[model samples]
Target: MSHRFRKPVNIMPTPTIDLAGPVAGIDTHTDTHTVAIVTETGKHLATDTFPTTSNGYQQVTEFLSAYSVVAAGIEGTNSYGAGLTRHLIGHGHVVFEVLRPTRALRRRDGKSDPVDALAAARQVLTGQALSIPKDTTGPVESLRMLQITRHQLVATAAKLLTLIKSLLVTAPVTVRQRYATMTTTTLVMTLSRCRPPADVTDPVNGTLTSLKSLATTYNMLRAQCDELDNKITDLVEVINPAMTQIFGCRAVTAAELLVSLGENPQRIRSQAALAHLWGVAPIPASSGRTNRHRLNRGGDRQANAALHRIVLVRMRHDERTRDYVQRRIKEGLSKKEIMRCLKRAIVREIYQVLCLGRPVRQSSGLRSDEFRALRSKKGLSQTQVAKKLGCAPARISDIETGKRRLSELKLTYEEFLKTA
Candidate 1:
């Protein structure tokens, strides 16, 4: 009716609306993965399942791209989601590690791929998941692979050795007597060389044959371990020469630390983070009037073992560390407490070397200035001396300062002189 007298009214076309891209969450499995896409405002847009294969990865990424994925949260970045995490990062998407849903949350929300994936996305959007996945393409990855292989080999050898020992317990008296006084190496060699009788009907012959077979397997595994050890040693020397230079850190120990810390040392936020990661950080157990911290029984046990080894070596041979232990003992600390302290301290020292890239000062009996001059004369950096001696550079400084000796370097005075 208004159109009868009103001037022509202009109608404005609805402006185009632009919504922000969605974030993605992945629930990874061995053979397949469930992916959920959620809008910036927390609305679930879609859910899809894909195979855990190269082509599947490509297809998943493509599907996410269609929805304009801004970021992704992936559960088990170190395990099931490792491949996808790598792919997403390589494609320039910001990726965050989504820890497994807690038992409480799982019970409350129930569980399904889409549910978990949605939860992961929510965690990412809300900043609940903050861990940056490790770069798995570096030398550290190679070291990890080798370390895992070596560890398996070692475990297998131990199991085989145990079986052989059990067999020997019931073995023929002649066989037991022959191996009883022998060392492990000697026994293995002897058993491996035994000429078992061809008569399978005889118990002794059967026992001999079984022993030889076990011994042969043990020897082969040992040989493989040795080869792996050499490879690990070479790789460690190249990856971080400074690691092997620490007084108590051998190639194996250094390799373990490297694996624990990853290639990018900066991934360890701080010395405290490292301590926590290795379970060397004491947990506060104080309640009310009680003031105390208890041993942390979490984190990487392998890393804890590595730190414990360093503490043992230092306690046995490091004068300063020995003095510290004595003082702590005089202060009425128990051995366990002392060990905890030592592990924490050792973690600090290792953190300095690994994370901060600093040389650890050893109590080696040498003047700092003298070591400096000697290093200068030899055209070596603190790192070079440490690498060559398989001890920390700070130890080299200590040796030069006359506060520490060269003995811990596994080198005689003459060898030191030649190297210097």
Candidate 2:
């Protein structure tokens, strides 16, 4: 018997019902969301709970129509409240991201959904919650999803590698002697090709079977990660090639920055704001006699990590950066201080590329299409070019089609074209 399975459809929300003015707030959770409507003067008008779903979001909007929502304060605009935030924004209601109430505040006010919701509303009315949530309906969103998946795949592969090594430690003597000393790639390949008995009653066979399964999983995840890397590179190139072209800013790093900036980069007012968002901005810890700044520990940690990577790479490979590091060290700055300064400078450069919209780097003074035309004029096929360059033909095709960016290869290709 064949059973046909159909996908569930999303019912599009209708036009929002209009009403008189009031502010709203929502306390969101995994299964349900609590909504509190408050008047202009901070008086609670109504409180209601709705399921966290398409229909529930729609109902919440309808319920809010009882009073015209001037602004809605929502916690977790990037997590549990994401769907509702999008729904509210799509319906033309202004939304503000509300921070969680502090423990002291919670203790004073008493904790409850209605109380929290009203707090959010009151925060908005008082102009406390001011941040506009990231607009996720853009290419940056796609990059974020890809980056997240790639991070998970890499993490899973790492764990599998660790598990495989751990298993080998306790593996049978013969098995350990046979496979333990190989490099990761070799070990995975050897284990993946292992032929253990179908019945795993024997300890040796059980270990071998487990190793084989884990090795295979590791290989699969690695392949997925590679595929995702290609996608990320292409997408980041599209979003802002200039960003990726910056020294030490690869596709993954660029994607992290773009995700943090969101689709609407303009919303990030200045380089200082950008630095603050990446947690690179120093916080003043001044007193009557002592004046010092401390490292900021807030903002998107992933973005901060990306900045750290860029600073590290530049410190190693970039001559100017190295010179700056030395100069800072001579000026009584420690390695940590040097890194912080570099991160701030890097943020400024990033701001120029992402927010100021720097022009994309020209590959050997030609666009992808122009480069392809130049190759055609030279009467050389992609395979011929790839062979001459000692790379795969697919790589040549990807570069020519703008699916990949190999700066060195492109320069070499340009020289080859000129000679041909």
Candidate 3:
């Protein structure tokens, strides 16, 4: 059954404190922290600066205890502001991660660290910062950390690949061209079939040796990354089983979704809040009948990358995705419009994963076991798959590799009678 997306508001939160007297707002940086303490009567109780470390945390807590602070306002609790927020919570302080105002707020009041801190204090003072969610606690933190590390590794892999390609051009005899597409096993096999060219000059020999060392280092890093990725994927399966069940979802997509969910579901008010946080939520730009908002150019770029992986995978692997997007194209929707729809649907899935405490969608029939069974029973040769599907053998090879999907074709006969 299809599901409706929900942005769940905590229907129940015990407001234990009336927040009398004073409130403190904190702004943190890598090196230092600035905090503003203001009383109910608009008097400056105290403004203190502390180093952003364990010592600073101690000092901040001592300052809070002096005034018996009702609550704290902290800027960017999920990003730059997170360390302080978590630190304060660890020390038993009720903290609200304050949201920065849009450009309009800046134009009106001006921007400064003191002003930002005071604004955070004011948000708590006025009950304006009630929308923030609490951190999820433990397991989510592991997933988020794994994702951050994986991303770094993947980006490094790309640069390493470029280096490998360059070395291949300059030192072609050291490794065969076929090794370019092969993994370490196949790479060694390809190398074993050839020998280093004797035509190499002394300088070129040194360079080739360096390239070999680089390749060794690259393989080690890649192996380490793969091991970490495996652990992260396994952890995701345990923490959020639904992650393993979603249609068109892969291990990478599941890991990313888990990371984006963070340590707490309560940290986000709803799925729409998440969409906005990730910058997937479209904005209106209506004026004088122009009615066009440009592409979202902000939000957590890393989070968006995770979502993009999901979209690209769906576009390539899931026939349902192709049908939906193709239908949009047939109706003359712009590429951007179709992409927007895909992003929204992904956000909907994200909501399900977080709120329901499920890591992914239900299995339904989207299992590898089922996929393999269908493939075997189809009994369709490569030539038939290519001919009937109106594609070439190489293209058909890619589909089987799971690198691409057969475009504009019916399902193989074993699957055709199974479902639409």
Tens digits of per-residue lDDT for model 1 on 75-167?
Answer: 998899989988888887777777778899999999999899999987777765357677887899999999999999999999999999999
Cα TM-score of candidate 1: 0.80
lDDT preference between candidates 1 and 2, better one:
2
Candidate 2: worst 10 consecutive residues by lDDT?
Answer: 8-17
lDDT at position 15, candidate 1? 19
lDDT of 2: 0.83
Most accurate candidate by lDDT: 2
Given candidate 3, what's the lDDT at residue 27? Answer: 75
Clashing pairs in 3: 133-266, 133-267, 136-263, 136-264, 242-359, 242-360, 243-359, 243-360
lDDT digits (tens) for residues 1-420 of candidate 2? 111213211111121322247989899999999999988887889999999999999998898876778778898999999999999889877877888777988999999998899888787776643577889888998999999899989999999999999999998999999986899889999999989999899899999999999999899999999999999999998888888888898889989999987888877777777887888877666689976667779878999999999999988987657766786688788898788878987887788789889754433656567778988888889989999999999887877776766777888887888888
How much does candidate 3 score in TM-score?
A: 0.71
Candidates 1 and 3 compared: the better one by TM-score is 1
Segments in model 2 whose C-alpha atoms lie over 4 Å from true places: 1-20, 360-420
Q: Point to the candidate with the largest TM-score.
A: 1
Name the runs in model 3 displaced over 4 angstroms: 1-17, 78-81, 99-116, 126-137, 171-201, 288-294, 358-420
190-224 per-residue lDDT for model 3 (tens digits) = 43344445555765555555556566666766887
- Model 3 lDDT-worst window of ten: 1-10
List the candidates' TM-scores in order. Answer: 0.80, 0.78, 0.71
